[model samples]
Each structure stands twice: as C-alpha cells, then as structure tokens.
Target: MVIQEQIRIQTRGRNTYNITGEVSEAIGRAGIETGICQLFIQHTSASLILCENADPSVRTDLERIMSRLVPDGDPIFDHTLEGPDDMPAHVRSILTHMDLSLPISQGRPALGTWQGIYLWEHRTHPHQRNVTLTL
Candidate 1:
C-alpha cells in the first residue's frame, strides 16, 4: 500500500526546523510497519535534510559555513528580484536536497539516535513551506 500526505511548515527565517516528530506521526497514521518514507519539499528556496540533532551547535556551524560558501547579496548572481537572499537561497537549496528517503521500521522512521529531519529554510523571511510525505 502507498500513502501520501502534505505537511505544512512555517519557518522563521533562515534556520533549520525539526520535523522528525511530525514525520513520524504521519508514518504512524499511515499504519505502515515496514516501508520507505519519502519526503519532498515543494519549494525552490527551501530544502530538507537529515542531520545531527544532538547538539544545536551543529546547525549553527552549518549556517556559518553555508553563509561563507554562499553569502547573500553576492554581485555574481542576477536573480535578486526577491532581494539579496533570492539567488543565494536557491543555490543553497540546490547544494542541499529537495527531497529525502528514509526507511520505515516498526511504524516509525528508522533514524539514528542523533539524527532528525529538518526543513532548511534558506530565505531570510518567514514563509509557509509544504512537504509531501509518501509511504
């Protein structure tokens, strides 16, 4: 059997928002004991990731490194219609991932002890993001 659900996430600017519990809840509702859970973010400037959730500093360091690698307002980009963060956000999403696939075991996402799912908002302002979950 296959099940699909769309999860709405509101992000508060450029940061990673954990969605592990939400995803697991959806999986539980699906009643699928063993299957593959696929998540897809339906946005260009945002993405998804499975990262270390044990420490908050990991995410902070990631932001620091990404800012250095793709600084906002870079003069090289020509798609600044949405402001300085426009093109950079798209680049960051491209560098990360627009989708993720995880194994579902015993009616839950089989994530490592320190692993959690996150919605990486590359934009600098708050916005509503949509993630489609398939099982």
Candidate 2:
C-alpha cells in the first residue's frame, strides 16, 4: 500500500527542527510495517536533513558554519528584492537537501540511535513549512 500525507511545521526561523516523532506518527497512521517512508519539504527556502539529534550543540555548530559559508546580505547576490536573506535561503537549500527517504520498521522510522529527521529552515523569519510524507 502507498500512503501519502503532509504535515505543517511552524518554524521560528533558521534552525533545525526535529520531526522524528511526527514522521513516526505518520508511519503508524499508514500502518505499514516494513516499507520506505520518504519525506519532502515543499518549499524552496527550506530543506530537510537527517543528522545527530542526541546533541543540540551539533545543530548550533551547523548553523554557525552555514552562516559563515553563505553569509546573508552579500553584495554578490542579485535577488535581493525580497530581502538580504531571500537569496541566501535559496542557496542554503541548494546546499542541503529537499527530501529524505528512510526505512520503516515496526511502524517506526529505522533511524540510528543518534539520528533524527530535521527540517532545516533557511529563512530568517518564521514561516509555515509543509512536509509531504510518502509511505
């Protein structure tokens, strides 16, 4: 069976959000015991990632590194109409990912002990993000 659904995530700006529980819930709802669950973020300014969720410091360091790698308000970007962060947001998404595919076992995402699903918001302001899950 193929099941598809979307979840709305409200983010407080550029940060990694742990959506592991949400995804597991979706898998439970789907009632698929041993399948694959794919997650896709339906936005250009945001992305998805699977990373270490055991430590908050990992996320903090990632945010810091990303900011340095793609500093906002750079004069090099031409798509500045929406604001300095607009173009940088797009770039950040490009550098990251738009989707993730994880194995589902016993109605739970087969993630590692230290791994978690994350929605990486690239924007500087809060926004409603939609994540489509296919199981």
In model 1, the worst 10-residue window by lDDT is: 1-10
- Candidate 1 regions exceeding 4 Å error are none
Q: Which digits, one per residue and each the tens of the lDDT, describe model 2 over residues 1-135?
A: 789999999999989999998999989888899989999999999999999999999999999999999999999999988899999999999999999999988779999989999999999999999999998
Task: Give Cα-based local distance difference scores for all models.
Answer: 0.97, 0.94
Model 1, 1-135: lDDT tens digits are 889999999999999999999999999999999999999999999999999999999999999999999999999999999899999999999999999999999999999999999999999999999999999
> TM-scores of all models?
0.99, 0.98
| Prediction 1 TM-score vs. true | 0.99
Worst 10 residues of 2 by lDDT: 104-113
Candidate topping TM-score = 1
Model 2 Cα shift for residue 75 (angstroms): 0.7
Quote the lDDT for 73 in model 1.
100
